[model samples]
Target: MSAPVVKGWCPGAHRPMMSGDGLVVRVRPRMARLTAEQVLGLCDAAQRHGNGRLDLTNRANLQLRGVSEQTHRQLLDDLANLDLLDPEPGLESRRNILVQPFYEHGDQTCRLTEILLDRLADLPELPAKFGFAIDTGSNRVLSENSADIRLETGMSGGLILRADGSQTGVCVSEERAIDAALGMARWFARHSSPELRRMRNLVRHTSLPGHWTGKPPGPLATRSEPGFTPKGPLVGAAFGQILALALDDLIRKSGARALRITPWRQILLEGGHSTPAPGFVTRPDDPLLTADACSGAPICPQAQAETQMIARQMAGRIGGSLHVSGCTKGCARQTAASVTLVGRNGRFDLVKRGRAGDEPAMRGLTPEDLLTLTDLT
Candidate 1:
């Protein structure tokens, strides 16, 4: 099998990435919240045009995998009908904004996100992967997520435009937050070349403003399990994956007004309270919740070995978070895993307390052997 392809850019509904099974069409919902009707339509489209699999990305985007070329146009039309598609591809590509999920309607988070989306056309062309995180909630939940420019809560309970790598940021109010963020984007565009696309990369070459001493925002609230939040109940999808049928069933049964897609593999339902959903991880201690696994083997042309199945089987045996990657690319989890098993020509290479691309402690072990060895270790 050929090595897994890592496109520096992300795939969208208009521009999809080719995978082993078929095309992967990604949908970035407005504010990462989908209405109940929109959710049902998305599931229907996935069931009809794709492989009946919907993968939730770390960026809180939903992807319909295994989409056939014949059905691609129809799926796009369906998405458009659901008000999910962007008429212009350029605007769509540039509208990579992630918002905190717990915001109420007409709140600061929603207002700022709407402003950013409207002004996406005004910004200079950026790398497809470059994005903005609007984490201006009671606490910051997206610091751990990927975002070049952040509009987060300042230590003094105000707004700040903080670069990803820098501790200091320029303080701004709600009215001027977007302008400050856009200013940062323009600055990055002027200073950056193709090689330096992200804010972190630009920070290596240029220094950001240190005039404002507002510290980074607060910690993320623990919401990765099936439980009740102020907004509603959250349901966890194992390995950040949900079957189209199961999701459709859950939406129908839950009677939720909307579904808030979170980066942590959890989906918040807008309702009075939380309820346990079948075929979902409802507990915090579920091993699958901690394990990160990519779609491997026949599903991905780059994979030489199976991954998700092995990750599920090995989840209980491993002590901490485990990443069973299809290859050295480590697409599943960017962070270092407690135990990483990298796939190579149908065999596994183990990297203890390191990332998938890190130096391996052992090589060329079968899946069974790998599990037994990890058990002993």
Candidate 2:
């Protein structure tokens, strides 16, 4: 059966509305991978066809917000030309798959990931947030906080696919390794309600399949540290536009085509290493990494200031992750970072929370004064 057509708020659509069932519209520009030319094209397209702004999602994906209905078709067509669209719409959001930067470089893990995408694309009910991680046996992969399903190399030339906190399947071949993951995803889709959008959610309520014995698998030699850094030095992009352009260029220049869009609004470009050109920022200590801002004010109709601009100004100055929202909607990151700046009128309010959704202390402050609030710093 063909996948279900997603209903509700289509992202990048011109309409300012909300939909419980959101649609993930895929775009492909020549630079999905990072190359200089591709990066420029992506930036130009985003500026012209989108809200003249771009957002960097925690998953490291570049989202062009405020896309009008007229441009939506063009965006999809363009992305398709770049081979960015998943064959099946059902798999669009569920394609939350990741691979270790090291293992992804011309290895079996990368090949297996493609197969997994193909398999999940055919499965209609996978949750919109269903995710997979294939470790390239590198230290710089995302933590378990980032993936619902993970594949790590095991001792004796086998692979182990873990679900939530337990090992569910083990295989000797990469093909079988990915197949084991798809089996679990399809099972979750069959048993879960549409409201349970993530694998963790499903795991919270349901027991494992009968085939799942809950037995611990054999010890694997290649275990990834929870938050191991990837092979290269960490780089941060001020916003999604910079990231999109940098990624496009990275893909073009370096044969290192595998890209991992992280949830931290950071892009992980694997393979060849290159420095950012003039007018672009790539340092970890850059202010952009320290701050996150939403599309605010004039652009969002729901914002108070151009949060991105404010954030860019305060990036490196702030010590922890400071999220700047145009309004309470908070489209920046899912989990609250160290500090949050919610904009209202020309002023801002400060909130402190350990995680995304925690109640914050809504005290007001000005941008200039915010620089002095040293608790987070």
Candidate 3:
């Protein structure tokens, strides 16, 4: 089989990347949230102009796939009408910020995010994938997510601006955090080359100022599960993929005033009740939560085999973290897993305790073979 191409750039609503099925248009909801009416409008557009699948991205964004070029204009129009589209493509692309899911309006996270959003135009020209994370909650939630700069609360309960790949950050007041972050961005822009596009990469090659290395961040956040939260009910979606119709039903049945996406493939139904909704994972221990898979076969041209179905079949049986990727690209899960199944020529190459691209211990395993395999753990 041919190798899968890795695209460094991410998709945006104005600049979507073409996929096997169609255009993959990404929607970066400000502060990682969407109101009920906005969500319903987006669902309508997804069903009418694109595939009915709404992808909850690891970056806490949403994507509508399978959009044809002919329908793309109409889809853009619909999104604009819903106030979802940013007219300036550059502004939309530059606003790649991730927020902790539980932020309230005018809170620290929201206020910092608003300041950053207002100043996006002031940011220096950098790589498309460069991003920021607002993790100022009592517990830092975006520690694992990708970001060039991070605004987080320190162990001493003071705000700090940290560069990714650094253990400590520079403490700053609420009013000056944005300026300090922008300073770090300027530093990155000056030091980074084509080979060093991300801040994490640049940080490793050069030393940060002595002042930016002493204030430790707050504790890591506890895992959020499917159940009740102060905001409302939390829910999960298998493979971070949700059907538009299922989401529509969930919103209507649960009466969710808003939806907040997370890096953990879960959603917070703000002001919503815990109601039984079909096609939404309401159990915290759902087997699918431990498994990861990407769109394979017909949906992804580079995929060698069908992925999601086999992933669903092997979830509970795998006994631990499993990553079933379409190809070596491992789009589903970049990190390590207990069992990594890499698709090749319509078969799976099994790699134990590694990533999808790692050397597989077994090759040419069929679906039936996987179903009957033992000793996965």
TM-score: which candidate is best?
A: 3
Cα-based lDDT at residue 57, candidate 3? 90
- Model 2: how far residue 189 lies from native, Å: 1.9
lDDT of 3 by residue, 1-377 (tens): 67789888999998899889899999988888889999999999999989898998989999999999999999999889888888999999999999998988889999999999999999999899999999989999889888889999999998988999999998999999998988889989999999999988888899988988898999997777889988999899999999999999899888999988898889999999989878878898898888899989978889999999999999988778989998999988878999999999999999999998899999999999999989675
Query: Model 2: per-residue lDDT, tens digit, 176-259?
Result: 666677677777768778676666677778877645533334443332221224444234456544534445555556444455
True lDDT of residue 136, candidate 1:
82
Candidate 1 local lDDT, 207-297, one digit each (tens): 7756533466555555446677777888788888899989888888878899999988889998735555888887878888889999888
lDDT for 359 (candidate 3): 94
lDDT of each: 0.86, 0.55, 0.91
The worst-scoring run of ten residues by lDDT in candidate 3 lies at 1-10
Model 3, residue 208: distance off in Å is 1.9
If candidate 1 were superposed on the true structure by all CA atoms, what would the RMSD be?
A: 1.8
Error of 1 at 360 (Å): 1.3
lDDT of 1 at 284: 76
Worst 10 residues of 2 by lDDT: 13-22
